[model samples]
Target: MVRENPTASLASLASGQSFALTGGTVILEDGSQSASDIIVGADGRVVAVEPFLDTSSCGACVDIAGMLVTPGFLDAHQHLDKTGVLRFTPNPSGTLQGAREAFAKYARTAGPDDIHKRATRTVERCLSRGTTAIRSHINVDKDAGFHGIETLAGVRDAEKDRITLQLVAFMTPHPGQDFDWLGKNIDGAVALADAVGGTPAVSEDPPRYLDILFSAAVKAGKPVDLHLDEHLNAGVHLLDAALDRVERFDMRGRTVFSHISVLSALPRRDFQRIAQRMLDLDVGAVTLPAANLYLQGRDYEMLPPRGLTRVAELHRMGVTIATASDNIQDPFVPTGSGDMLEIARWTLLAGHLRGDELSAAHHMITTAPARLMGLGKDYGLKAGARADFVVTDCIDTDTLVAGGPDRAFVFSKGRLVSQTATETIREKEDA
Candidate 1:
């Protein structure tokens, strides 16, 4: 399970006692920076995080110099299984419907081996970019079948120690309502995946469809994450219906909704009413700015909606929200480099988070996503937390949100997982 990179150092960094990362600026949860030392025990957990530390008892003292360290970034939502198929399955129309039909057609011939290869490559890229964890949704339907589930499981097992990976068994609620195939395996998918996902927004009846999804989650005893009303001017918000199920099933704090972009389409009063309900019911939300902006308002001619949710307002209303990359190089979204910092940067722009709020924008990718994923208190830049973090050239929140440079080093469980060497290409001579 420990995948040792051929180019990585053969000599293991694991040792007895502890080690200290000295001389780097550590960014705390509060967005404040301090020149500090972080001590990692041999077991790969933080034993001390402070401005100063005595490193006399450590096995190694890694000098990170001017680098800044922050908790490893997390993609609370992504599509690992479908990454890297952009060229083969281009969406000429560049609309959501086109993507659905195109991907479904290509999937018929794409076998398990194909899915594994693409998913693993994406996992590696995400790790290289300082993301230590990911929650991916693999399509599960009559079209893709359970093969996507097995493919996701294989990639996660193969890279077990390098990062945290969770799967969401995703089946869009439409497309022939193939209940015979889906109904037979829906519960099985839930049992296999870390969470269950579906788009009730596309179903014939939204509220009733949510109840069905909820019943499945309760039966499988897994949490739920759904794609709800991603289209703009959607008449009804399934978010309201989801709340009814939460109360009916007592499934508080165990539900999440992604791409609820229709919240932007709601009237201000209605938006606040639903926002208050989201806070009261303890439901979490994830905004996929890249795909949302790309697909949502294509039909409109002038002044189309931004396709972004009210991120700033959601944060202000005490609702748990995180920004994530929903698709990477797939038909639904033609572009995404698998960088969480870039996703955060887009959230700042598309979601209108600027100025002093940049700190919270950074949180949308790191801290907020970590908490929404329920990684617990042991997952951030804190004492006794998991020794998963990245060292980059950017120092403060502003530069971090801007995503100016690549990460210099990535560490997981107190061991070096990835390291980068910078080289600038010389520009061509003057004409």
Candidate 2:
């Protein structure tokens, strides 16, 4: 009975208590599904994920048979503070320059309350979409100053229960120039955020830019997440330069690099070599396909590139490759839904993931990002892990990837944070 309508079934169950999810086909790390009865303990941790569990004494059970069960999604790269601001802000050309210019204009006047409200909405939207974790980038340069950092910091704490929000203080200074504002406010942003990030593509002196970014993060004793080589320049070597900083700072496994779009411009041999280097350094790659697809390849007239990194190659090299929604309705790309599944769909299309590789595509949004953000100590649909996951109305990954499945329920620490069910309505137009 519960299988047909998980929303109504879950609604009848008490909140904050442990229960068993019976007969559900839980998605494994490999994207394959298995029939496993998940027994969430009273403490909101999974006690067992075995096939055909004896739930006779479960007291209460929710039959999730045939549903797609998996760990909650994680967005490794996001601009939460800038979400839903396009109403007033306009991006006419849809180029990277236009995005920066538009945001620069808006950021100058956007206050803390406004930033907070929009960020809150984005966080709530992500939570409802089964993304229980987010690593959002907040601007800390001259245009936005520390307002983005401060506003998102508050939202991080407020939404702590629903989503594990990690703020990365990202500097958006011009290439070859340093912003004086971050000099005094860098500590403040680092004090409130989990990591520090910067764009090396725009930095005229990429090496020097990385030095300042790496130094600040080291001083703050946090990991570094960088927006490296976000352009289509085949000669761009920020990825190689960043490896130096990561090695010098010994930040391997503690570092993540997003938007390595130029990596695709490298030759196959060089790309393979760099992929191995990334694995040896324990660094991960985060591809923001949604924003990249929109912002990149605009200058090219014919046969434009997908504006994405070599996701499959890096993954094949055992390098953690995660995908995320980088910007949400802001100057960058101008389109976002705060939904990781949507990002996953785009990743599949833009990244050229097919067949058996589909599971890897799913991993890009779920388990892969969790590992990149260092949240894998006890994650995934495993026994003794936190009972934080999502259920979509699909039998397998193929169905789920095809889209249109609502996040019937989202659980965080064994508490249902969001619940929804499809209510098909037939209506006639009133004359």
Candidate 3:
């Protein structure tokens, strides 16, 4: 029997009590949507999800009939430390090196309070747009040191109730610092972070740099997320070096490669071989189309490449692939809104993802990133998973991914975190 409470309200469910979100088209594990009722327990976890869950024991039943319910979006790769600093650190050249130089200059005087303020604001923006989990990479070098890591840790603690934040100790190279400096400071940074990461392509010696990162991760039993070959120069690549390190450290299934933009320049055969290697090792990939498209291909005059990884090829090959907003309103890419759906749209257009593959594109921001972040067993619509989800008027995945709906209800741990709605009106035209 179906039971509906006439006087129930969605806002009432935020009181940390038992509730049932009934009559919604819930996105299932395989990216399919079905009309289902999600029963959330008093402890703020999903109790059951079925066509008609027994909500007789629930305190409130809010019907979301005609709405689309999906797991909260996840961003697997982002630079929170550098977000929202466009005005303070302008990249006039609008190139990758220029951004790095601008940020390095700013980092000389950047304090924890400033970093915390900017990062917290970005987190709020991401949460309002339905991102409940984020894995942000913080730079750790002689120039930036531990300011970013410490400040983001504070942000994570303060926003624990609203979002899940994982920090990466991104070991970067500085001109004044040698490999010995990284080797000396990496373990401490890794100790303070949830994962270890670095840009191996920019290091003086790629192999030695990767060895230090992998060795630290192995010692700490932490996951590895690397910014690998984030350029168009296919002649100079580091995928082989990184793969060898993954194999040496036995980091299979716990490693992720972000922004492999160079892969698009490789021939089909070479791309296929590398893709197979990634699959065999259970390594994941995250494509940051927004940053890659902006920073790469600037040296070309005509027929410049899309400057994105082969997202379609990797997806077709059954590799664990995802997309993210790498740098938001920073020197790296000065335009951003902290919205994952916007990232999805960019991926669709730049990566040549067909309209028929909307579900796959949707997964790039939701399930695919969730899997890459190792959000295992507790990040879905199934029973016992965390009741973190977004409610929108879009009826299916295609409508949700093509362009997000104007209105959305974001819930974290069964608590209403954000509710956004937009209304537009224009003068009536002559009929």
Candidate 4:
């Protein structure tokens, strides 16, 4: 059962036990931190964050010798239905084209039972790795039809207590086919949602398709996310149209662009102008590094595309950029363990973001994604904040990312929901 007031109840749980995190450095925003003791109250909110623990009035105290404590994770973008399809079919062709083909086959063969089983396993792994929330896009096309919506909604409701799942109804149209029918169906889906989705860049006439989709989104008064320019083709300019419409519709901060891989190949001047426009429009960007790197570079033979978007530049320009796994162990890119830490590791290496930037990359998995999910005051660890956190074996943000925690202690609204441990022992055999 879902608690009426999760945060308050978590605070009440914390008030009962005075946990002392000794010898561990706490990570904070703005690139600085100090040794801190966090006291959670019975009401499920963090009651106090101090330099030392004064446990005079507490009933129980956990001595975290030198482990790490950090905010729970939030995965920005994923496909719950597709993620579960990976167990059987692995992408052999290894390009977006091939993956799309494989997805078509898998969607036809896969059933709701299969999708749910895989998704539940994947979500369990995410919780084990400290992720508390996810934004999964459910395909609502003619193939699976309403099955995608119903199945994902079921997954959302089932996992709601453990992990917050936001649903994005994605509309995909076949090439050279009329999207009128698909468009009507998309409108119907949007009517049932808090937001809508589009892939105008993938359409035959991107400018026209963009107009149709965003206009639909505006009419629905829902937020929008577009899969724009996902390939590194120099000729692709659909992102410009998408952004232009956002400006035209005054949907600043309500519009988002995901997977604009072409920007990585654009000239510095051109990229700068686009970045500025995104900042002006308050539009966010989501990059799926694993999927991009895996599915991209297919058409090109040698010196293939990097497959990553202009992430660093966007951040430098104050654009909100988040990272996503996109597909986990599916027909596309085929090998994901459903852990956001793995996503961040590859992202940091591929995106060339380091040091403090590493921490920023961490945010792409945590608070940044939360911000995009409309989880406003419910995102962090503080007084009046939801008591959602993970205890790990690291001292600060850097260590949390670098040293994959050996164990994760998870709590949602003060109730222990999950715990994980990975044990390994290596020693010299015959010295």
The per-model lDDT (C-alpha) reads 0.82, 0.82, 0.89, 0.73
Q: What is the C-alpha RMSD of each candidate to the true structure, in Å?
A: 4.4, 2.9, 2.4, 5.2
Q: Write the per-residue lDDT of candidate 4 for residues 136-162, one digit (tens) a residue.
A: 777777666766667778878877666
Q: Tell me the tens digit of each residue's lDDT in model 1 across 74-158.
A: 9999988788898889798998888888888888788999998888888888898889999998888877888888888877877
TM-score of 2: 0.92
> How well does each candidate superpose onto the true structure, as a TM-score?
0.92, 0.92, 0.96, 0.87
Can you rank all candidates by TM-score, best first? 3, 2, 1, 4
lDDT of 2 by residue, 297-359 (tens): 888889989889987777777888999999888778677777787888888778877666767
Positional deviation of 330 in candidate 4, in angstroms? Answer: 0.7
- Can you give the lDDT of residue 308 in candidate 1? 88
lDDT for position 208 in model 4: 72
Model 4 misplacement above 4 A = 1-24, 29-31, 41-59, 87-90, 191-194, 422-431
Off by more than 4 A, model 1: 1-17, 424-431
Error of 3 at 28 (Å): 0.9
Worst 10 residues of 3 by lDDT: 1-10
Estimate the overall C-alpha local distance difference test score of candidate 3: 0.89
